[model samples]
Target: MTVTLAQAINRGIHDAMEADDRVLMFGEDVGKLGGVFRVTDTLQETFGTDRVYDTPLAESGIIGTAIGLAMYGFRPVAEMQFDGFAYPAFEQFTSHLAKMRNRSRGRVKLPVTVRIPFGGGIGAVEHHSESPETYWAHTAGLKVVSPGTVADGYAMTRAAIAADDPVIVLEPKRRYWMKDDLELPVTTEPLHKAVVRRPGTDVTVVAYGPMLKTAMEAADAAEEEGWSLEVVDLRSLSPIDTDTLVASLQRTGRMVVVHEAAQSLGPAAEIAARMQQEAFYHLEAPILRATGYDTPYPPAMLEEFWLPDVDRILDRVEEALDY
Candidate 1:
């Protein structure tokens, strides 16, 4: 079946709720509105108000409620509505959502999933377009995962809901409309395992979420230039699949990391550090990063320049190959 990324997420949530009565969803405008992107369409009508409902426009309150519900043994999937909007709930996320199990000495497990629509390229106004994955990925006790394809969106969402610890699902807003032909309830790799999207022998291009598509395009273009670019999608960001990444690097002998987030202390930096430590001997060049500038997300018109695109990614690949 052909399904868009948004539809895949909706079906994933619907299936999870149907399978587990404890899996409940609540967030701003998620009920009747079906989310800003309509990703939750038809869920409320199917499950009624109790299982699927709406909440006030309070990110902190939404996350707080999810934590409380999770403690009560309910697998709560909370939505932040947009990327920047999640900032209001940072305190709740870092202090409570990410530390509950440790604080309780492993007795209390918070099976909470916070679904955040993140990244740019839709040309929305301020606060609507942002990539805040690094914030959650940097926090301990929090599992951060993002899906680049329809299959992973479904499988990863189910995985997040079933997890004993809290998980942050960063949906690439730009890729929401991207479609693929695949049956429902499809399970791909594990939540934290990185998959090689395109195999190559020259350089490895690592990306996740919105940037995955861009990296793939770069790989195709690189082929015309006689460079084989292996693309690896980092499905799980927090507990990164270093094994997969190291294996790819060992094969390619060069690497370039890409993301929509700022370059400073971003996921790319962490991956580069790990690759150096684990597979330094196999590296042909210093791992380079093609990412957003170390500045705030620019206005809608300037986003094309701000976000990492195919040209920028290929530039990094060329530089890595030169080394």
Candidate 2:
């Protein structure tokens, strides 16, 4: 079926709810309004108010209550509306939802899925376009995963809901409208594994979510310059697919990490360090990063300069190739 990425997510939610009685969802405008992106469109109608519904305009309250529901043996999928809006629930998520299992010595489990629309290129106002996945990924005990394509968008959501622990789904808002003709009932793949988007040998580029398309585009452009760039999509940000990444780096001998988030301490830094540790002897050049500047996310007008594009990614690849 040909469907938009957001519609695939909606189907994922429907399948999850149908497959598990414990599965339920709540978030701002998710019910009657079908979410700000319409990703939850008609979900409440299909699942009913008890299973799929809306919550008050409180991020903290929504997450805090969802945590309680999870601890009580329910699988709750709580939407944060936007990446920037999710910060208000940080205390509830990190302090309790993320720590409850460890704190209880395995006596309690938090089977929760937090769906957050993240990243830029949507020309959205402030608070709607930040890539805050790093914060959640850095926090211990939470599984952070992002999907780069329509197939992944469907599979990862089911995987996230099935996880016994907390999982954060950082949906790329800009890619929501992208279309794909995927077979229905797509089998779920390992949520923590990375996949090669394009196979090459001259260099390896690692990216996920909003940046994966950019990385692939850069690889396409690099081919014309006689550089074969392999692209790895780091699907799981927390427990990164080091094995896949190392294998790719071993083949290419050079790596370039790309993301829309600021460069300092971002996922790119961690990926670079891991490649250094695992593929140190094979590295032909230092792992370079093409990322957003250290400053706050620029206004929509200047986002073109702020976010990484094919040219920026190619520049980093050139540096690595030259080395």
Candidate 2 segments exceeding 4 Å error: none
* Residue-wise C-alpha lDDT for candidate 1, range 262-323, written one tens digit per residue: 99999999999999999989999999999999999999999999999999999999899888
lDDT of 2 at 279: 83
* lDDT by residue for model 2 (1-323), tens: 89988999998998999999999999999998999999999999988999888888999999999989987889999999999999899999899988989999999999999999999998888878898878998899899999999989999999999999899999999999999887877864599999998999999999999889889888889889999999999999988989999999999999999999999999999998888998899999999999999999989999999999999999999999888
| Model 2: worst 10 consecutive residues (lDDT sum) | 180-189
How accurate locally is residue 142 in candidate 2, as Cα lDDT from 0 to 100?
A: 94
- The stretch of ten residues in a row with the least summed lDDT in candidate 1 is 181-190
lDDT for position 1 in model 1: 92
Global fold similarity of model 1 (TM-score): 0.99
Q: Output the number of the lDDT-best candidate.
A: 1
Error of 2 at 212 (Å): 0.8
